[model samples]
Target: MSLFSAAVAGFGTGLSLIAAIGAQNAFVLRQGIQRRHVGAVVAVCVLSDAALILAGTAGMGALVETAPWALTAARIGGAVFLAAYAALALRRSLRPAALTVDASAAGPGGRSAGRGPLAAAVLTCLALTWLNPHVYLDTVVLLGSVAATHGDGGRWRFAAGAVAASVVWFVAIGYGARVLRGLFARPVAWRVLDAVVAAVMLALAASLVAGIPG
Candidate 1:
């Protein structure tokens, strides 16, 4: 296939994988709606994905497949984090009055009132991105192997396309969430969002614990 065809294939694949409703996307949506460190959060996600995509394109996916222990460790850690985050979401859902688009609603940490909201957002975004084992499966193992199908030059084009998809998807969600601020201004809206977040997080955690590929 030509380089352009390879790029298009990679772009489509990357978008499909990243567009899934998971912990990372959910967190980004929340941050976007709240208008809390939106740029930072999006940056962390896109950059992390780029790094992983590069690694996968470089053939690190094969190495990852050889190490069952690494995936097991990631699954355990991701499950724990997701579960804890779900609890937080559940708590927020129960307290509708506390739910607001204002940054002061939860403070910078997102859990409680403290300093360094940027730091908290960055850390949470990183965890949600890196801790998930599926990320490795998609960006590293899957995307890498697929890229290899193209010729040597075509593979680099494919990787570029994949990286571009990540950039586009993240920027759109992170920035586009602002359009929903009017709706989210209502406390009930926050309750619903948090409830949904809770469900998604718990489901993902359960899947991870169950050793599911998705």
Candidate 2:
């Protein structure tokens, strides 16, 4: 196949994996709506995906696919993290604080006017990216395998296409979600959103547990 065709195929494949409503997308939406270091978060996501895609393109995906134990460990760690975040969301739902709600509010943890909050936000972004086993499974193994079908030069183009998809997705979710800022402006709406987040997190955790090594 031609490089252009391969790139298009890769782009479509990447979107098929990421466009779904999953943990990573949810966190990015929340951060975007909260208007907290959105650019940095988006950058982290795009760059992380790029690295993972490149690794896959370079054939790391095959090596990873051969190791089920590593994915099992990641599943356990990710489930624990998601459960903790779910509890936090539950707490937020039950005890609705006086949210700033305006265009300008503190971080989700409610800290402002310091580097601490920004640093914390960055850490959360990294955790969300690295801890999830699905990211590796989809981007690294699955996408990498797909790219290999395109041959060497075609595979690189395919990887570029996949990276482009990541850029588009993160930019859109990290910025487009701001459109819902007014809807989430009320404490009631915030509570509802947190409840939804909690549910999603729990569901993801359950799935992770189900996938654990028996």
Candidate 3:
């Protein structure tokens, strides 16, 4: 296939994989709604995906395809990360909404106050992108498998297209969702949002642990 064809194929594949309601997407949406380091969150998500897509294109994905041990380790690490993230989300959900603060007071004295929003966002993005076996299966194994059909030169083109799609989708989701922050200003809305995030995270973690195929 030509480079154009490869790019189109890669774009479609990337969209299909990322359109799902995964933990990473959930975290991005939640952070956007909470108006907490949204730019940082979006950047991490897009950049991480781009990096992975690049690796997959570079034929690094074949290494993962050859290693069962790598897959197993990824599964274990992903499960732990998801479980911990779920617990944190649940705690935040259960906390009284009155404790939430405006973005201005979102510092140390703020409700969800922490010194590591950027770090946390990066770590979370990494866990969701790298540790998760599904990410590898979809972006690396599956995408790489398909790209291989287009010949060696086409693979890089495909990967580039996929990375581009990730950048567009993640940036839109992370920043665009911020427009709804006002609607969630009420404490009840905050609680409801957190509750939904908690449920999504927990359910995703359980599904991952259950070895559900992506």
User: Which prediction has the highest lDDT against the true structure?
Assistant: 1
Ranking by lDDT: 1, 2, 3
Alpha-carbon deviation at 196 in model 2, angstroms? 1.1
- Cα lDDT tens digits, model 2, 1-214, are 8999999999999988989887788889888887778899999999999999999999999999899999999999999999998898888787755343554445456754223367887898898789999999999999999999999899999999999999999999999988998898788887888889899999999999999979
Model 1: lDDT of residue 175: 93
| lDDT score of residue 57 within candidate 2 | 97
Candidate 1 per-residue C-alpha lDDT over 1-214 given as tens digits, one digit per residue, 9 for 90 to 100: 9889999999999999999999999999988887778889999998999999989999999999999889999999999999999999999889775677866556433564322368888999999999999999999999999999997899889999999999999999999998998998898998989999999999999999999444
lDDT score, candidate 2, position 159: 97
| Residue pairs whose backbone atoms clash in candidate 1 | 108-117
Clashes of each: 1, 0, 0
Two-way TM-score contest, 2 vs 3, winner: 2
Q: Candidate 2, clashing residue pairs?
A: none
TM-score, predicted candidate 3 vs. hidden true structure: 0.86
Error of 1 at 80 (Å): 0.4
Measured on C-alpha atoms, candidate 2 has an lDDT of 0.88
14: Cα error in model 3, Å: 0.5
